[model samples]
Target: MLNAVIIGCGGRGQIFAEYAKQYPNEMRVFAIAEKRDYLREKMKKEYDIDDKYIFSDYHDLFEKGKIGDVIFIATQDNQHIEPALMALSAGYKNLMVEKPIDRDLKKCILLSKKAKEYGAKLQICHSLRFAPFYRKMKELIDTGVIGEVKHINQTEGVGYFHQAHSYVRGDWANEDKSSPMILAKCCHDMDLLVYLTGSHTARVSSYGLGGFFSEKNAPEGSSARCIDCKISDKCPYNAVRIYEERPNTTGRGAVEKEGFSNLEDAMRKGRYGRCVFRCDNDVVDHQVSNIMFENGATANLTMTAFTKDCNRVTRVMGTYGEIVGSFNDFEIYVKPFLGNDKKYEVEKIESGHGGADTVVVADFLASARGEKEMCTPIDISIESHAMCEAAEISRRTGKSIEIADIMSDKEGALL
Candidate 1:
């Protein structure tokens, strides 16, 4: 069985390690590094790892030298690089770091180049690329049923409550602390768009309303916290309803290490308990990015947090026909200019993120074992990351940003 050392045993790390439980014969968790004492202890007990293999600081874990077949770096957006550099330096040759690799443009490219220099296999965790829903989409597009991919129009419906939970009051609320909404939330889509077109982004022009979720938009009766708000009963984003009454904890600090320290007292005093509109959030509530690919294809991506359900709706237009689908329905429709329309439906999955999370771990394990080629390698990951960084710059400056200016390396279509 392949072995893994989980860095940052938070939500993502825990989810990746879960694959070991599902298929113990294929892989197992050998060690864990986490800042939270509780999380480290939790992983040690669950994985049956010895005390020597658990660390409150990742430095200690890396200082121990390579301990497993691969390392899973699932730290925060800005925290991925240091641990990754440490891992590569420690002689660990295979790694799976979660998406939005880093907010810094140069650092993203640097990490990939460093991995190449070290002859290491690095994969970014853009899990949706492994989702069956998108996989079938790729399969159909690759078959040329839709002809040359020319234009893609996609929308990420960041549902109201979900947006309120994740972007307004959770760990990703601030750009300084985390990442821009585009990179942190929609980098998955950006990467998939690049994958779909089989080309890298050449340029991007983006616009967004960054102040929509601020105190200026708070309702009349909205107080600082849901527990104290007079309109908590009528407010849709009531933290109490989300974290307690209904118990649907998507981002209301389900991971204690993510900052909602105590569930019982959090409703009155914690970050998750704050009113969504009044929180110190700076990410956009609505964003639109117009993109130009190196191969003459174009795409538009829209992300908004006002939809009823959190899902994605995409339409890919080609030379011969067009394809459209909704992730909420877990299906796609292929309509050709002359052929009969076809509908493909994906059955509901038991694993999280529609089973993409577990599938990525499985794929990573096989790639680490040299049984299969890595799907989302470092260069491709950098390409997607550069796209988002350029979009963010455009969103801020009102000028179209060129990926070439952002990436010094002309790898892929960047040339």
Candidate 2:
């Protein structure tokens, strides 16, 4: 069986360990590295792993654990590159890292080069690529059923509820702590656009703003948490009404109990610091990007946190036909001809993104054993993340940035 080591024992890390349990024949989570003692102990009990294999530092695991065949790095956004580089240098044969490679494009390229030099099989974790629905959709497009793609428009509605849970109050509140929203939330879209066009982006222009959710934007004389905030009843961004559908229910809602009553309670007993409004939360809550592809194809991407849900809406106009689809549902419409009747199809995919995480892990194990090719390679993910970084730059500069220039300048190198 292929042995794996996990760095970071947070939610995603726990998910990986559980995924391993379901793939007993192909893999096993032999060890994990987490700095928090409570999490280390919790993971040990939850997974029934020996205490010796749980380490306080990932480097310690690399130094002491049996030679790991694969390493999965699921650390926070800013902490990904360090553990990834360490795992690679320590002779791991397979590596799977979460999206954006790193907020710093330069570091992504450097990691790619180093993985190549060491002959390690590297897979960047953009799990949606492995999802059955998106995979099938991509297959249909590739088969020419949708014809030559001429233009594409994709919408990623982050939803105010989800944004507050993930961006405003969640782990990714500060841009400095976890890359910008573009990289944090929309990297998947960037990858999808690249995968669909079958060509690299030529140029990009973007604009965005943190228009709605903030202390200044919040109603007057309001507290941070939903329960104690006086305006929780009317505030659009209140966590209780927005997320859990209960403005009065505190502590047992979607977020931890500590942050429910007020910002003071949040600071005293929460992961995010007391400076909820003052922390470095500079990431945009809404953004739009216009892109030109190498084959004369163009795409428009709109991402908004004020939407009502967390699904993507995509419309593609090709030379021969046009197609529209929704990520939340399996409904798709294709208009092949002007006078022809529209064709509707219902797509059914398995749960958990149609088992994307399991499929990707299986592929990683298979490819590492020289058994097959991987769908999402290190290079493609790097290129997509590079585009994301470029879009962030374009958003800041308010100018059309040439992807070619950005790529050539290695502006993708670490932040």
How accurate locally, in lDDT, is each candidate?
Answer: 0.85, 0.74
Can you write out model 2's per-residue Cα lDDT over 1-415, one digit (the tens) per residue? 8877889877667667777677687777778898877678777887777777888988788786346788889887878888888887788868888776888777888888888998888898888787665676676678786679988999999876667666776667678878888888888788888888888888888999874555665556777445566655676665445534533322233333332345445544554322234234667888998889999999988989878877788888887777777877766677676557454554453444446766777778888888998778788887677677778898998889887887778853443
Score residue 61 of candidate 2 by CA lDDT. 83
Which residue pairs overlap in candidate 2's backbone? 104-415, 105-412, 105-413, 106-412, 106-413, 106-414, 107-414, 251-257
Full-model lDDT, candidate 2: 0.74
TM-score of 1: 0.94
In terms of lDDT, the poorest run of 10 residues in model 1 is 246-255
Q: Candidate 2: which stretches are off by over 4 Å?
A: 241-268, 271-280, 338-354, 411-415
TM-score of every candidate = 0.94, 0.88
Top-scoring candidate (TM-score): 1
| Model 1 CA lDDT for position 345 | 89
The CA-based lDDT of model 1 is what?
0.85
True-vs-predicted CA distance for residue 31, candidate 2, Å: 0.3
Candidate 2 — worst ten consecutive residues by lDDT sum?
250-259
